[model samples]
Each structure stands twice: as structure tokens, then as C-alpha cells.
Target chain A: MSQALLFYFFAAVAVLSALGVVFHPRPARALLCLVVTMFALAVHFTLLGAYFVAMAHLIVYAGAVLVLFLFVIMLQGAGAREIALHQRFNIIYLLPAGLVSILLAGGLIALIRGSAFQALKSVDGTAENIGTLLFSQYLLPFEWTSLLILLGVFAAIALAKKDAA
Target chain B: MIPATHYLILSVTLFSIGILGVLIRRNILLILLSIELMLNAANLNLIAGSAMHGRLDGQLSAFFVMVVAAAEVTIGLAIAVLLFRQKNSVDTHEIKELKG
Candidate 1:
């Protein structure tokens, strides 16, 4: 019963905030809603027994990413977006795009249908287990992903510089 | 009593909404926010599958995914700023100068 309730709560938060993020007209409100969604997803990660992932989500996304977004929106000023949105709202490009999205979703569900289910055991999805696996089985990819993140940071900085002039 | 398919379906539905946001919304900020939604949906599926499969690989990939999402948004926002500087508006509709 507890598990079911937890699932319902997280799912509701995730789904609702997700919609709010997309549907909110104001840029700041939309960014804030997405932040709430990311935070709730962190809780869902905790419920799934991945404590490290939960904490990482909170720290990286809620702490860093959303803060960056909020700062950017505030710095750019909300009045500009409001003025533009008031002038024109064209959604004619969305119909075909939405259909393509629906088709992609159907494809994902069909792919999952073909996969075999393996029952879980021991439920040891903790930080210790993650650390163990990281050092033993996934050491190479661990370093590689770190390199990828560094490259991403550099690329972002470079992009900003290239257009600054 | 939870089925794995439930998580998958929820992720798919959220992904679809994100796509709609990207495709439908005219604001660049909204488009970027939609991208975040899509990435979160992917992360949820990853963690859920990690729990079900008795492995940490999915969770690790999810960590990387979050990192990349943050990085992508930063660069995207920066570009949006540059565009705003040039064009004075963030509307995807009216900012189409290179449409070919």
C-alpha cells in the first residue's frame, strides 16, 4: 500500500508539473514548474532505491541548471517575452509534429513489449553498490562520461564566446 | 503490484508532451523547458529500469544524461541570449530569418 501510494504521488507530481512547464505562458513560471518536476523526480529516484541518483538530481538539476535558467530569464527580462507572445501565437506547425511525436511514442512502447522481464533480487540499489560497480565493472565508462561532461562545458563556453561579438 | 510497463508508459506520455511543447510553443524559453521535460522523462525510465533490472548501469547513464541536459540548456540559453540581442525577441515564429 505504501509503495502504491508513493508511486501515485510522484507520478501525479511529475505529470502535472510537466504539463505546467509546457503550458505556462510566462517564462519564469514555466522554468519554476520544471524545477518542481525535477525535484519530485529526485524523490522518485530515492523511492527506487538509488540514493546517489536522487541526490545528484537535486544538486545538479535543481541546484545548478534551474538556477542558471532562472537567472537568464530574469536578466533577459520577462517583459520582452510578454510583448512578443502578445503579438503573435502561431501553432500551425504543431499538428504534423505532434503526430510524429505520437508515432515515436508508439514505437517506444512496442520496443519495450518485445523485451524480456527479469525479476529483481536483493534490492541493493544503494550508493555503495553503485560505487562498487563503478570501480569494478564500469571504470572505463565512468572516466569517459566525465570527459564528456568536460567537453560539454567547454563547448558551451566556446559557443557563448563565438557569438558575444 | 507495480508493473514495469507503467513506468515506461508514463515516460512515453511525458515525452510526447515535451515534444508537443517544442513543436507547438513559439517561445524559445518554452522550447528549452520542453527539452528539459523530455530529458527528465528519459531519466525516470532509466532509474525505473535500473531498479527492475538489478543493475546500476541505467542509473549511471542517467547521471550522465542529467549532466548533458544541464549543459545543453546552458548553451541553448546562451544562444537564445545572443539571438535576443540581435533580434530583440524570442519568438520562434518571428525569428525565422534563415528558413529555407
Candidate 2:
């Protein structure tokens, strides 16, 4: 019972804050809302019993990713006026986008409702189990991810580098 | 324990909201944030499936998704910064060179 309550509470937080991220005018504020949504999702991961995943979610997303977002938003001064102006002209796209999203959600939910999910015992998401799987079954992909991150770092630097005038 | 279906529904809702944000938002930064939302929603689905099936594979997949998301965001924000530097604004409508 308590688990359900907690799940509902965090789910509400996640949804509301996600909406904030979308609709908030100021980029900084929207980034803050996204952080909130990330934290809420982290909690959901915990509730689902993926302990290592929950921690990774918190550290990777709420910690590293959101801080990066904050730095970018701060570097660029908030542009409320520009956003307001854009919002005025972009109202035409709003209704159609909202309708499309609603239809997609509805269709997915109906499909999920029709499927019969087996009630298997929940898996243990301990670090030990994940580590074993990572080093054994997933070693190749794990090594590849390091390469991906290294490439990402180089790309970011190359793209964001200042030109010598 | 909450049913996995409920979690799936939540993920779907979150994903849809992300789609809405990506479609309607004019700010490039906000579009990136929306993309993060969608990725997180997918992560939730994977974890839920993992819990439902009592397997570690789904969790591993979610972990990979996080890695890819981090890489994508790094490149994406760098591009956003580049766009801001060249254009002086992050508004999508301001960039029309690609319209042709």
C-alpha cells in the first residue's frame, strides 16, 4: 500500500515537473524543472527495485547532466522576451502537437492494456549482479561505451571551441 | 508492489509529454531537455520490464541508454553553444539557412 502511494506521488511530481520543463518561459527555470523531473524519475527507479540503476540515474542525470544544462543556461543570459515573442507566433503549432501527442499516448496505453504481463518475481538490481553481467556478458559493449564518451568529449570541445580571429 | 502496467502507463505519459515539448518548443535548449525526458521515459520502461521479468538484461540496456544519452547531450549542447555563438540566439525560427 505504501509503495503504491509513494509511486503515485513521485509519478505526479515527475509529470508536473516535466510539464514545467516544456512550458516554462525562462530557460533557466525550465532547466530547474527538468532537474526536478530527473530526481523524481530517479525515485521511480528506486521504487521499481533497481537500486544500482536508481543511483546511476541520480548521479548521471540529476548530477552530471543537469549541472551541464545549468551551466549552459547560465552562460547564456535568460531570454524571456525572445521566448514570449516566439510563443506568440508559434501558437499555431501548439494545438496540432498536443493532439498528436495525445493520440500517441492513447494508442500506446491501449496496447499495453491489452497485453498480459506475467507476474514474475522481481529481479535483484544489486551492483554485484550488474557488475557480473557487465564484465562477462556485456564486456565488449562496455568497452565501446568508453570510446563513445571519449569521442563525445572531443566533439564537444571541437564544436564549442572559440575561433582565432 | 505496484503493477508494472501502471509504470508503463506513466512512462507513456512522460514520453508523450516529451513529444509535445519537442514539437512545440522553440528554444533549442528546451528541445534538448524534451529529448532527455523522452530518453528517461524509455529508461523507466526498460527498468520496469526488468523488474517484471526478473532479469538483469533490461537493466543493462537502461544503463546503455543512459550512456548514449550523456554522449548525445554533450554533442547537442555543444552544438547549441555553437549555434548561439554564430546566431546570437537559440530560437529555432531565427535560423532559416536550412530552409532551402
Candidate 3:
């Protein structure tokens, strides 16, 4: 019972914060909402027994990536006023929006009705298990990921560096 | 007990919101943020499915997803910074010229 409650709570918060990320007028405010969504999803990860992933989500997403986003927002001096919102509603867009929402709802229903979700397994996806798997069958991908990070670092530096006139 | 369906539904909901953000927002930074949100939704699905199947593969994939997200964010923000410097604005509509 409690687990269900927690799931509902986190899910609600995640969805709401995600909406805020989409609709918030200011970029900085939207970034905050994005942080909240990440935190809520981390809690969900924890509940699902992915403790290591939960922590990484918090650290890498809320900590590092979001900090970069905030820094860029600050560097750009708080957004241009004209671009705060891109869409002005027209009567024509209403039909597409409604259709998309309906399709999304149908997808949700199909997901819930699937047989794979009928049983709840209480498995522990602990960090130790993940680490074991990471080193064993997943070792190749693990090494590749580190190399990708290295490439990303160099790419970021090259991309962001100012050019001489 | 919370079934896996609940988590899946949540993931879909979050993904839809991210899609909305990407579609509606003009600020390139916000669009990147939306992309992150979508990636997190995918991570949530991986973790939940891992729990459901009694396997660590889902969690392992989530780990990889995080690594990819970090790399993408690094490069994306760097581009955003460069765009701001060159164009003086980060509006998606404004940076139309390819030469810059």
C-alpha cells in the first residue's frame, strides 16, 4: 500500500514538473522545474531498486548537467524577452494538440493493459549487482562509455572556445 | 505493491511533457533541458523494467543512458554558448544562418 502511494506521489510530481519545464515562461524557471523532475524521477529509481542509478541521476543530472545549464543561462544574461515563448495559439493548432493528447493517452492505456506488467517483482537492483554486471558481460560497453566521455570533454572545449577575429 | 505499469505510465507521461517542451519552447537551452527530461523518462523505464524482470540489465542500460546524457549535455551546452557568442541571442528561430 505504501509503495503504491509513493509511486503515485512521485509520478504526479514528475509529470507536473515536466509540464512546468514545457510551459514556464522563463528559461531559468523552466530549468528549476527540470531539476525537480529529475529529483522526482531519482526517487522513482530508488523505489524501483536502482539505487546506484538513482544516485547517478542526482549527481550527473541535477548536479553537473543542470549546473552547466544554469551557468549558460547566467552567461547569456537571463534570456531574450521576445523568445520567452514561441507559440501563440491558433485555432488550427488545437486539433493537432488534442489528437496528440489522445494518442498519448492511448499509449498509456496500452502500457497498463500489457501482461508483462501484471506481476510485480521485488528484485533488488543494487549497486553491487550493477557493478558486477558492469565488469563482467558489460565490460566492453563500460570501457566504451569512458572513451565517449573523454571525446565529449575535448569536443566541448573545442566547441565553446572563442575564435580570434 | 506498485505494479510496473504505474512506472511505465509515469515514464510515458514525462516523455510527452518533454515532447511538448521541445515543440513549444524557442530557447535552445530549454529545448536541451527538455531533451534531458525525455532521456530521464527513458531511464525510468529501464530501471522499472529491470526491477520487473529480476535482472540487472535494465539498471546497466540506465547507467549507459546517464553516460550518454552527460556527454550530450556537455556538447550541447558548449554549442549553446558558442551560439550565444556568435549571434548574441539563444533563440532557436534567430540562428538561421549556417555560416555563423
Poorest stretch of ten by lDDT in candidate 1 chain B: B1-10
**What is candidate 2's lDDT per residue for A80-157, written digit by digit as tens?**
433575452366677887787778778877877788886635688899999999999999999999999999999988
The best-first sequence of candidates by TM-score reads 2, 3, 1
For model 1, state the Cα shift of residue A75 in Å: 1.2
Query: What is every candidate's C-alpha DockQ against the true complex, given to 2 decimals?
Result: 0.60, 0.73, 0.63
Model 1's CAPRI class? medium
Model 1, A1-165: lDDT tens digits are 897688778888888988887777677888888888887788778877778889988988889888888887787787225434443335685787678777987797687788876543225567788788878888887787778778878877887788645
Give the candidate order by descending lDDT. 2, 3, 1
Residue A130 accuracy (lDDT) in model 1? 78
Model 1 score (lDDT): 0.78
What are the clashing pairs of model 2? none
| Candidate 3 lDDT, A1-165, residue by residue in tens | 887788888888888889888777777777888899889988888888888889988999899889889988977986423332334212354456557767987977876666545565666767787788889999999999999999999998787565742
Q: In TM-score terms, which candidate is top?
A: 2
How do the candidates rank by DockQ, highest first? 2, 3, 1
State TM-scores per candidate. 0.88, 0.93, 0.90
Interface residue Cα RMSD of candidate 3 after superposition: 2.5
Q: What is the C-alpha RMSD of each candidate to the true structure, in Å?
A: 2.6, 2.0, 2.8
Task: Give the per-residue lDDT of model 3 (tens digit) for B1-100.
Answer: 6867777777877877776766666778888998998898888888888888878888889999899989998999888888888899777667788756
* Candidate 3 TM-score versus the reference: 0.90
lDDT tens digits by residue: candidate 2, B24-81: 8888888999999999999999999998988889999999999999999999999998
